[model samples]
Target: MKIAINGFGRIGRTILRQILTTARGSGIQVLCINDIAEPEMCAYLFQYDSTFGPFPGQVALETGALVVDGRRIPLHQQANVTALDLSGADVLLDCTGIARSTDLAERGLSAGATKVLISGPSPAAEATVVYGVNTKDIKGARIVSNASCTTNAVAALVQLVDQVAGIDSGHMTTIHCYTNSQPMVDAPRGDFARSRGGAQSMVPTTTSAMHLIDVVLPHLRGRISGAAVRVPTASVSAVDLVARLNTPLAEADLMVALRAAADRSPVLGWTDQPLVSSDLRARPESLVIAAPETRIVDSRQLRIFGWYDNEWGFSARMLDVAAKMAEAD
Candidate 1:
């Protein structure tokens, strides 16, 4: 599979790293990378990532291209998707985050990509897959989304509970880590709340993940609501999800159901050990249920704590989706 990545940000770079390291024998090759950053600078950033540490192999700039483990991958310092030469690419992963419109996303197809996968939620997406939740729906989808990290973290639990007891309604509060979109220092921006420095405070922000959940699980439409707060952290995000189920279960049975779901789904992980946010870094699964922290209120209400490596986990899922798309072709 020939792949092209549009953005070299958090998720994009991680996807490239995964394809180069863990996905080596999967027949996936990164044909080209298109980003606004200069080729040399992109090499530097890819070589040294603070959150995930250094690249496994040496990354050097050779003849205006990035050479990773003797493999040369050209980097194009272009923002216009239509100008990219992606004819050899079978899949284009648009981690740019700005390609939220169909017109913008279709540029990849126009540029010669067979399939386009957006890293984040996009309204134009034919399907928004949440890995274990609804990946089967992406069998023949050309332009799909992997959904947001938060949605991936919650979708499995939602589906598992809905199947076991049926979810009547739910609300999620995601304690998320700061992202590149936020300002590092207090600076003026359109939104007052977001204008505050990301590293300086816990800022409440609106999340589009709930809308994405509705797309993946239409039965939860109009029944689920959610909010997010970006805390001062470098990595790892947690979700506090509370749901009202149609059926009630004892604590022991509830645990059994959750464990069974995790066992059936490779994207979901269940752990009873007390874990901190740092312990979840580089975890490949979409969601890790903190079993010890899960609580049940009045039997009908359930509160679950889930953790995820937002960048790594989500990027891993993106690659999984890409592989599925490639196989379908």
Candidate 2:
């Protein structure tokens, strides 16, 4: 199965790297990459050993191909979807984060792909998927979304809470990693006022992930409220989730349910020990189901913490889900 990626930034390159390491790599023939950045630099980024962490072996760049674990795989570069080489590709993962579903979806089809998946939620699209909660909804999904990392973490948490104790309501405060949007030196952006003043500040930002949470957890509509805090870190983020349960259980039982639920879903995990946001930074997987301290904010209110490697984790699951959907067809 051949695959094409729309952007070569964080998520796009991560997707490329993961596919190369998969058991299906040998059968996967071509990897088509499209980005506005210098294609050579982007290609080189995948060639060298990842600074985030080492994979099993080094990946070498060979002329117009990438040697993953010593196996040669052909590469093609394009600046945009219009020029992308997707002739034999069965799937396309759009990590551009442009959120333009119609354009990317059409481009994927035009490039000869049967399915198109995106790394982030597309508000205009039909399906927004959280790996554990709604992966089964991917049937006939020519266009699908991984939902943002915040969405994934929150969705999994809510699913677990609702299943074990039943949710009366839920809310989240995502202490997110800084993104390309903010200035490193407090320079002015087009929207000068909003991001202008806070180069080093803990910027309070509106999260689309909150809206996406409702999309993923349909039962939580009108019951959940959400917000975000964009921190100075480059990667990794945590969700501070609080939920009012229909029935209250002891803290130990709650942790037990979370661990059990995480075990049932590969995307979810529960670390028995203490973990911080920095601890999860650059982890290859998206959903790390670690529940920190549980607090009762009110009579029925409970607060929990979860961590994720926002870009890597979310992109990884997006690729996994898209591949599974393709194979199912």
Candidate 3:
């Protein structure tokens, strides 16, 4: 499948690397890139990544293209999506995170792409698929959303737990990594707390994952609520969840079921060791169940912890969604 990337930020660059490396068989071929960044700058950023280390493949820049592994991908620094020509693209990934509405995202289709995929939450999307949780909802929908990174982890974890042992209600807190949205040093921003230094201190903030959990797993609507804490970390985040289960389960039995679930899932993982955030760097699974931290109180109350490389895992799932979109056609 030939794919075009709209934004050449963290997610966009990672997606390209994943296709050539980890997600090699996903059938994704880079058709073109439409970003506001200069071709040379894009090549440089793609070459040296802070979280994933330097890209393994050769990265170079030509007249108007970025070359990776000897493949010359046309790079266009177009601020207007409608102005760029996106012909022959099986899917155009709108990773800009700015196209939140169907009207805004469908401009890819208007520009001649077959399908449009928003990398973040788009309640206006024809279908919002949290790949591992509800990719069944992705039935030939032209405009689809893979939701957000936190949403993917939360939905995958919640769905697994809910399927194994029934969950009545839960409150989740994601110990998330700070993004570019946050400031490097104390600076002016709308949200006072978020305006504080991102890598300096932990910041408590709201997450769209809370509301999006309801969108993907509609049955779990009103059952789960969550927030985020931006910790001082470069990569990898964890989900801290406390829930009351309909079927009261012991930790041992729950582990057995969850282990079995992870065994059968491609996008879910289980780890028994006492692993930290960096341990999960470059992990492809949306969430890895941390066995050592599982706790149960009153038998009915359940607590679970899941680790995820938010950037890598979310980009991996986008490939999954793109593949599904191509198959459906």
lDDT tens per residue, model 1, 7-117: 898888899888888843268888988889888788999999999999989789877578999999888887788897788888899999988888998989899999899
lDDT (10s digit) by residue, model 2, range 78-176 = 645766557677778777788565875567777777778877777545577887788888886777878888888788777877887888877789888
| lDDT preference between candidates 2 and 3, better one | 3
lDDT of 1 at 119: 94
lDDT of 3 by residue, 99-204 (tens): 9876788899999998988999886689999987888888869999999999999899898889988899999999999999999899989999999999899999
Q: Tell me the whole-model lDDT of each prediction, alpha carbons only.
A: 0.88, 0.72, 0.89
On TM-score, the candidate that comes out on top is 3
In order of appearance, the predictions have TM-scores of: 0.96, 0.88, 0.97
Residue 84 error for model 3, in Å?
2.5
TM-score of decoy 3 = 0.97
Q: Which of 1 and 2 is ahead in TM-score?
A: 1
Q: How well does candidate 2 match the true structure, expressed as C-alpha RMSD?
A: 2.8
Off by over 4 Å in 1: 23-25
- Winner by lDDT: 3
